[model samples]
Target chain A: MTTDDLIARLTGELKPVPRTAVLRRVAIGLGSSLAASATLMYFWLGMRPDLMTAMETTPFWAKFVYTLSLAIAGAWALKRIAHPLGSIRINLALMGALIVAIGILGFMQLAMAPPEAHYYLLTGHSVSICTLNIVVLSLPLLAGAFWILSGLAPTRLTVAGAAAGLASGAIASLVYSFHCTESGMPFIAIWYTLGVLVPGLIGAIAGRYVLRW
Target chain B: MNPVEARLKELMLASLDGDAKSYGVLLNDLARHLRFYFMRRLADAHKGDADDLVQETLMALHTRRATYEVDRPFTAWLHAIARYKLIDHFRRNRIRATVPLDDAQELFAQDQSDAAADRMDVERLLQSVPAKSRDLIYRTKIEGQSIAEVAQSTGLSEASVKVGVHRGIKAIAAKLKGGADDDR
Candidate 1:
């Protein structure tokens, strides 16, 4: 058949697509995943035994603010990176700034404290499992993000996957804060950032396979 | 930057809003463009097969339209789909002697295979050429720059730029063939 004839036959019985369907679907998926992760945190991990006392400390609030900021920035970056040709330079730069801020906080704490306290501050109580917990908690959020990508058209699969991973990791850390007893700025900054980045690295490697249409 | 591309972009945006008329119009325009695109690449003996490629490409575009990034130029996305169809067509014809065309058809019935990998391999192959020649080849072939423009940018005579690009492409093709042979 001629091209004109084909076009007519194909588009003749078209269904109207909802506007912003991609955005809406992904947003809904992420929201549900976040709720599920929060529930998991509450039950599986349980709120820290000293929740009331911990909240009273400046370090506790600082850690919460850091994770929350990372989560929000990561989520926004994920949405923007969904576009294949869309630039992620700004998003990456914002992440760099957040890391720098954490570094400054760590430096200030080091200068104010004595040498004997440095090691303890750096290790806190959960150095061994801190990063691992972040990755484990991120599983549900990563699955949901992948599901959303499957429904939409993401051109740069590896980058998009990494962005999703970064967002998921940040959300996982935010949830982990409720259960984690670590109070050192140095420990939170170092371990929490690594925890968030591990999934992003994994996503970059696996994105080509999983996110490909 | 072309008017046709701008118009196509507008239609695509409109179609996303549930405008069937705009969608139909965009597809019609694409079909017309694709006919010429495929015809130019196919040999005289296989020219008639361009319509099949066109049909396949159109179906792919329709199915994968949801993945289109709104801010991207529509032509770039359309061209990527077209390039995949062309490569598949060429690969099938090349191995037609041993691979029964019908059997091959069954294997490739789903056209959602990863074209990015192939494109990336081609890019990696291009990197084997030296920097100056590689830049020239990229500008002329991938970026669609005129030989005169490339020469001007690199401060070379148009003749030298043309020769460099031609040799660079030849080198890449030879290396790629060698790699394929090793794989086999």
Candidate 2:
């Protein structure tokens, strides 16, 4: 159908978004996700005195570092919040940074000492399992993705969100390629797509309530 | 314009004058108009960017509405909003600049399947030539406005319009052929 037909069909209910409200709503979303991530880590790895005591002995700082990094990054991103730039320059710029970081991490993996029994804090049966731990460790960055998608700009529908998600998924897969082993690409692609899809959905749904302006 | 279209136009015009009824009308009109706009685009697209474009346009219209002069033709204002929104669409989808760590082809080729996406690309090649020249084609071909109307409208000699159209057509034809080859 044509745009005219589409308009004719649903002409009575649309509302213009207010810019201030959208910004406020996005801030809330970011704040909530930050709280949730912290809460999750606290329960999973931090709250228990016994766990913390054991963790101090374990000498493995992966989970703690990852969680701490997430909180720090969230604070850093929140500090930079300002007016929405209608241009996609910022989105493209962030995508570039993600790409570079992925490459740097990839090179680090290749240059490092050969296989240790455990890739991170967790033990995995294979590279795919190890990759999952790495993915989990990237939560702070994933939260950043949420912030970007939510705060960037509104799209036409869920489709735009989906497209953005896929673009992100693809770009992320590219970055992951440089740091991850050859065996990890396909699984990374699939899981990364899933990871990106969630934000796209949130953005699209919230676009109705938050990003209209 | 039908009732809804007429109503929207009136509401837009009235809203300019600070009529509260018009504001509601505008929102209703927008909500109604956007759903179909997004839906149709989505229907044609292999990817659902049509939806994203819709919300973005709606959001932009909301953000940028203050810049619109209530005195101008509302249609012109509406079309302008559409054009800017389209510009944003291109910016989002275009090749992102990055530090080239990998082959350009590899970075682009992998994980992308936009070839499967079918968004209408209305690149009317004839539009690029010139409106003065296009007048000839419109008169003789599209509009059937005779040579006399073409001359009067453009303030050019009829003979000149005819000659320009002929030259324009030849150039366009060659360009299309080249474009076709490039596509292959």
Candidate 3:
């Protein structure tokens, strides 16, 4: 068939698309996955035992803010990348700055503490399983992001995937924090960040194939 | 934004509002723009692929129309999609930009010959088609041969020749429509 024929067929079935359709899909995708991840975490690890006291502590809030901020930044970047010709440089830069700031905070805390406590601060109690838990938690969100993106127009598939992964990973870390008892800035900076990066890397690699549409 | 960009953006917004006439006009306008855009960038040997690319890009645009943000520049979005289609075409066909030393002078030649280009395009289009259907299409469509003549020439029945042409066109159309679904 000719191009004009194709255009005619396309225009023949016109329907008004809601202005908020894309955002709504994004919200549904991430929100539902987040709910699932939370449920999974609740059943798997349960909340930290000293939940009330932890809520009052600065370190808990610090970890909360760091992961939440990263999640927001990732979502911001994902929104931009969902559109054609959208750039994620600003979002990436902001994420980098957030990580760096957290890293410095961790270093400062380490410097103030005596040398004997350095290992404890860095390793925490669950260093072996912390990153793995966060990654597992992010799986649902990552799948949801990929599903949403495949239906959208993301020109840079790799970057779009990475953004989706980053956002999902950050949110996973946020959920994991509730159950994690570690209060060290250094542990959160190192292990939590690694958890987020693993998903980011997975997204970047898988996106090239999954985000083709 | 320039006047053209402003006008196209207006039409696109209208199209998004279920205005079929506006959407048709916008697509018609985009088809011409994309044709020129692809033709200028494609190599001489692959010029025939421009129409296919144009159709594929338009299909992509139609399927992904919801991704267009009303506040952003429409032209920029269009350009990005167009560039992506071109890149995808190059990757699929493995078309290199290298010019043979003997044919270097052809790069500067300004001959606007249509027949030769059309033949080249027909050849490129048939490259991936199955050999039997490819030959049938080449003979009946490109060489202006009758179905009976192609059948006799290839020792196949006339019914098969007709079926071959029909299936070949359908295959090409299906290839163009691949991955153009909304998937929602």
The candidate that wins on lDDT is 3
Question: Per-residue lDDT for B34-66 in model 3, tens only?
Answer: 787678778898899989988998898888889
DockQ of 3: 0.56
* Pairwise DockQ winner, candidates 1 and 3: 3
Predicted structure 2, TM vs. truth: 0.34
Write the candidate numbers in order of decreasing DockQ.
Answer: 3, 1, 2
DockQ of each: 0.25, 0.05, 0.56
Clashes of 3: 0
Q: Interface RMSD in Å per candidate, to 1 decimal?
A: 3.0, 7.4, 0.7
TM-scores of the models, in the order given = 0.67, 0.34, 0.76
Candidate 3: segments with Cα more than 4 A from true spot: B97-184
DockQ of 2: 0.05
| Candidate 1, residue A162: how far the Cα is off, in Å | 1.2
Query: Candidate 2 — which residues are off by over 4 angstroms?
Result: A1-19, A40-89, A115-153, A156-213, B1-184
- Chain B TM-scores per candidate, in order, are 0.51, 0.39, 0.53
- Give the lowest summed-lDDT range of ten residues in model 1 chain A: A80-89
lDDT score of model 2?
A: 0.44
> What docking class should model 1 receive?
acceptable
Q: Per-residue lDDT of A1-213 in model 3, one digit per residue for the tens? A: 899899999999888989988888888888999999999999999998999999999999999999999999988887788988778999999999999999999999999999999999999999999999999999999998988887788888899999999999999999999999999999999999998899999999999888885
